[model samples]
Target chain A: MIRIGIYGLGKISRRVIQGVLSSNNACLYAVCSSSIEKANIFKKEYQAEKAYDNYERMLEDRNLDLVYICTPNYLHTKHIQIALSYRKHVVCEKPMCVSTKELNDCFDYAKRQNCFLMEAHKTVFTPLNQKLFEMISNEEFGEIKSIDAQYATRLTEQISDWHFSRPGSGCMFDIGVYPICYANRMAKSSIFRVSRFQDEALIEYENGCVAHIATSWDVDMENTAHIYGTKGSVSCKNFWKNTEAAVNGSKITVVQESDFTGEIEHACTCIENGMIESPVMSRKASLEILKVIGV
Target chain B: MIRIGIYGLGKISRRVIQGVLSSNNACLYAVCSSSIEKANIFKKEYQAEKAYDNYERMLEDRNLDLVYICTPNYLHTKHIQIALSYRKHVVCEKPMCVSTKELNDCFDYAKRQNCFLMEAHKTVFTPLNQKLFEMISNEEFGEIKSIDAQYATRLTEQISDWHFSRPGSGCMFDIGVYPICYANRMAKSSIFRVSRFQDEALIEYENGCVAHIATSWDVDMENTAHIYGTKGSVSCKNFWKNTEAAVNGSKITVVQESDFTGEIEHACTCIENGMIESPVMSRKASLEILKVIGV
Candidate 1:
């Protein structure tokens, strides 16, 4: 089995543990929480061999082959770098750092370490989005005319915490990064410049395609991206959900092109088979994502 | 020939004259420019018998059946009211007026005079857009999820020329009105609430549809709008240009759906066929446009 140590026992970290436990080829080796109490709870719940409050002490065990980094926005780069220095393959969560410089440095260190690193970029790994990339890259929609992608989550009194704080979290960097990534992925070339405002970000790529992306923690949550091609347009609602694809002005909707869950499972199996160093979230892609997020 | 009077002999007025003269059903009857010198020159060029420097004197002549108002943003209400008082069919340029109150007054006057009053919204006259609308209204694209519309004409140099001035004109009220209208049309509802910022407009309607419209007189120009439905999405470039509709995940790029010139001709012909008021771009519609623009 491919043993793994998960760092940061937050909500996302819990989700990662669920995903790992559900996978057939992987097993949880250890878990590192900020407190010994939470770590002990996770270890007892998951039947892990050990639990450690200090992540560095856990990394010294050398039995774990991979480390999952699921800390806050500020701690991602540092945790991933520490994991990489231990020569362990790493899967860091989104917004891996707060700036391009830190992401670049982390990438250079990963290259020098000669170990695998991947950002848990689930959007690119989804089935519908993969087909979207293929169709767009093939010029199926012809030349791109424009793009509008946005992710807005409502932060009413019921669910407002740590997201609206200054110096760290907000909608633009936290949720806006997905739509920006979508625009960057479908554009013919890299984004040349970005025009950022309070809750919106307009990015102009070199290939004459422009993307308008906005995010808001102030309103209810919505995840969607739309691409306007010369010949037609394509739209997807809830970019992170397993929703069906709907074609505008045509009879096609909910294209069952590929099984996304199956693909991800297969990738995990490949890693276990030693057929690949890591899974679909390649190190190179993670670095590019970091650059766009400026994190 | 249909006798026509031209009001507000500005640059757009010149374009309308060119279009009208080139048409078979219309001929110039009188000219009214802000200055007597310009009106006299236009009258001599078009071989008109009358040239009035003042609108009150021009309205008293009683020979013209139609009047086209191409004045500044703030002057639309005053000019349209005067034209309606004289029982002349009216076509006023965009923004309609500086505020919703002005639009309501114009609409009320048009109703009282039993005259035709349109805001000269040409985007709705595009053929490709017409096709998309037919498909959507016919439930071809299922229920709409959202509308992402934008129209940005890079004219930072002209920002000081009253078009981008505070209150009366800027990116949101000037070019942004087109996309807002499109969203309002496709959504089939009036906007209930709007959050405005320096660079963005977030509009939500009572009918469960949302529009994120961004425009800038300070940035490079890109004109486009994408309508997203639960079943599919439709898009057009240059909002004024009719273009193809590509369905999501489909490879085919159809062309007939892209041509919108036919629709413009048809809408204009409908006016002479006693279709004095259109469902799209009606007086009520202009009021909604003004509401979003916040005058």
Candidate 2:
């Protein structure tokens, strides 16, 4: 099994620990946080093998085969570089890097180090979406004609300051990436034209498909993703972490222990195969998300 | 009572006949078509008093107080002008005019002739939508913040050549006006910015409301309209003619004779009140729809 070290003990790391614990090909070996107390707390709760306040200290453990970076958006590049420099495979959270340049640099460094790397877009790697993609590839719904996905939430509680003023901030980078990644993955085509207005975008694909992706923090939305095609359509509510979807009105479901497990398992599988990067969430795929963000 | 004459015995005119016949404040007095046989057939079937093959012949009748113009889109300006010339109040079908210039010209002619004129936007005039608009105006769902409306259908059957090659021909002008008018009416604020991509548009309203309206002949969409506010949400399926809506989880419904009756009755009410245009669908309101079309 891949020995996974989590590089952040934020709220998302709790879920990552659950994912690694549930994953067949991975184990939660260690955790690092700015607060050693928090790191030790997570280690005790999730039964991790080690905890460290320093990222370098965690990376120095040669047994750590993979690192999962869940730091804030602006710090992703730095975390990824340190993990990769240790010759460890890495899975970084969404908005992996703010722009394409940062993305290219991280992947290029990973290439030089010969370590597996990928952006963790759990929306596409979820078993439910994986099945839908396979079905769409088989033309079950005919050629995709259009897609509409929206993710909006009211900011009810306090959030980190970086979410507002950092380089990779705002609702688009925070939550918009969910709908953007979902649409781009299902489209199975390259982008043709994109028009961004506020937190919404209309993307026209080279294969004659159009997608409208929207996000906001002002109000709550349906949080639904709809895929339309010539033959029929598919829709799922709360699609970012959904375990089920309606395929032309028929329910297709998957039992998921943790939504993040599939991505962890996939990342571990890629590392085991001696792959330098995930074929599914490759550098090109990571760049496409930023391309829609116009970075 | 308002004695109504319908011009252009096309497919939509049948519904107009049903509306007028069922209306308590209006009578279907005359039917006009280029084909005298078709006009005579419609008049007899709908119990009209007269049938004429020529527009001038129908307008010659002194009792024809109102003319409902259902001509093809590109010809709406001409029909509205001639009807106003006869001192007849007019209600033209959607795509009232292709451009703001034509809309102003026709309304100005109506003003000079002391005749009432309004565009028949059935989506806004539908009884259910009127109630929703009133509820929104009253802030029953708090302040409106976002609206999303879409109408799309596949071209399964051959349509008229005008649908492909006329001035107001594309999907945006054809059925797109439904969602545009719906969003504009619900927003209840002036437009701030608009981004048009293919047949989709994202509009920001002055009061901080955002609307995404879309249409296509390439695919069939959900055909739903969602109005989200600060506190709650409202959604209607097949919203163009829906008689019911879900308000924050509860169903609100209205009984209707024909979907077109509300607009026809509103037009007749405006003429009876000695008003030059409908307060609900004023000259400025009609211009806003065309403005979003970017014509």
Candidate 3:
């Protein structure tokens, strides 16, 4: 099994722990937090082998085969470099880095260390979306002509202040990536033209597909992703991590324990094959996301 | 009662006939077509007061106070001029003219002749949308933040060749106007920024509202319109002429005989008040739709 250590103990770490627990090819080796008490509690609660107060301390464990970085958005490059210094494969969360230069630097460093690294875009690795991408490639709906996807919520509860003061903050970075990554993946073509207003964008692909993507935290939305093609269309609500979708109005579903498990499974499989980068969410894929954000 | 003459006895005129017949303030006084047989059949079928093969002959009726022009899109300016020369008010179909200059010329000429002229945008006059707009203005949903509207259909049958070759034709003019006009009427602010690709557009209103509107004849879609705000949201299927809608999940409906009658009623009211232009679908409103189309 590919032993994994999580480098953050924040809210999203719980889902990552669930994913690691459910992954057949991996095990939860360690979890680190600035607060040792939270780390120990998480380790005990999730049956992890180790817990460390400092990230460097966790990376010191020779048994830790991989590091899943869920640190604050700004700390990704530093945390990634530190993790790779110990020769650990790393899977960083989305918005992997705010700028193209920073993201390329991380991948180039990982290459020198001969360590596997990928951005964790759970939306693309979700079982439902994987199947949808394959279907589009197979032309089940014919050439994709249009795409519409959105993610929005009213934010009933207060969020971390980091969401406001951090670089690449606000809804565009926090929520807009859902629709952006989803559309970019499904369009399957390089962007020919793009225009943006607010957090919404109209992207025309080189192969003639047109996509409109939007996201907001100020109000609620349907949160559905729609793809229209020459022959038919597909749509799913909460597409960022959906396990069910409709293909031409027919329901298609897959059993899913933790929505985050697919990414973990894919990452573990890549490490098992001695791959230095993911074929799916590769360095190039991460850069493309940033390009659409105009980084 | 406003005495009405329909200049084109084509496919859409049937709906115009139904609207006029059901209207409380207008009557179908005349029907004209290039083929006298077709004109006579429509006149007999709708019980009109006059039938003429020639356009100018029909517009000469002394009692005809209004002319509803549903000719080919390219012929709008010439048809409107002929009817206005006979001293009759006119309601021309959408895409009243091809460019900003042509539209201005038509409106300016109508002003000189002291005749009322307006573009027929039945979407804004639909009972369901009027109520939705009222709720928005009343802050029933609180300050609107986003609007999304789309109309798309798979062309199961062949359409006219003009759809491919007419100036300012294609899906954007034939169908995109529905979503464009709907969003513009609901935004209630001048555009701060706009972007377009294919037939989809992202518009940022000066009041900080954002809208994404799209339409196509290439594929089938949900054909729904959604408007979101601080408090809640509203949505309706077939929003261009819908008689019912859902406001934050509560269904709201209104009585209706014909969808086209709403525009007719509004235009007749303006005429009765001795107004030479529609305060609703005014010269500025038609110009706004064209502007979004990048005229």
On lDDT, the leading prediction is 2
Q: Output the worst ten-in-a-row residue range by lDDT, candidate 2 chain A.
A: A193-202
- Candidate 1 lDDT (Cα, 0 to 1): 0.68
Task: Assess every candidate by TM-score.
Answer: 0.56, 0.96, 0.98
lDDT by residue for model 3 (B1-295), tens:
9988898877888998898898899999998889999999998999998998998887777888999999988889889888888888999988888789989998998899899999998899878888888888898998899999999898888887887798868888888999999999998887787888887888999999999998888788889999999899999999988888999998999877888888998999999998889998999989888888998
Alpha-carbon RMSD, each predicted model: 11.5, 1.9, 1.2
Candidate 3 per-residue lDDT over residues A114-220, each given as its tens digit: 99999988988888898999999999998888999999998989898878898767787888998989999999987888887777788998998999888888899
Per-prediction DockQ: 0.06, 0.54, 0.84
Model 1 residue B82 distance off true place after TM-score fit, in angstroms: 1.5
Candidate 3 chain B weakest ten by summed lDDT: B160-169
Clash tally, candidates in order: 19, 0, 0
Q: State how far residue B22 of model 3 sits from its true place (Å).
A: 1.2
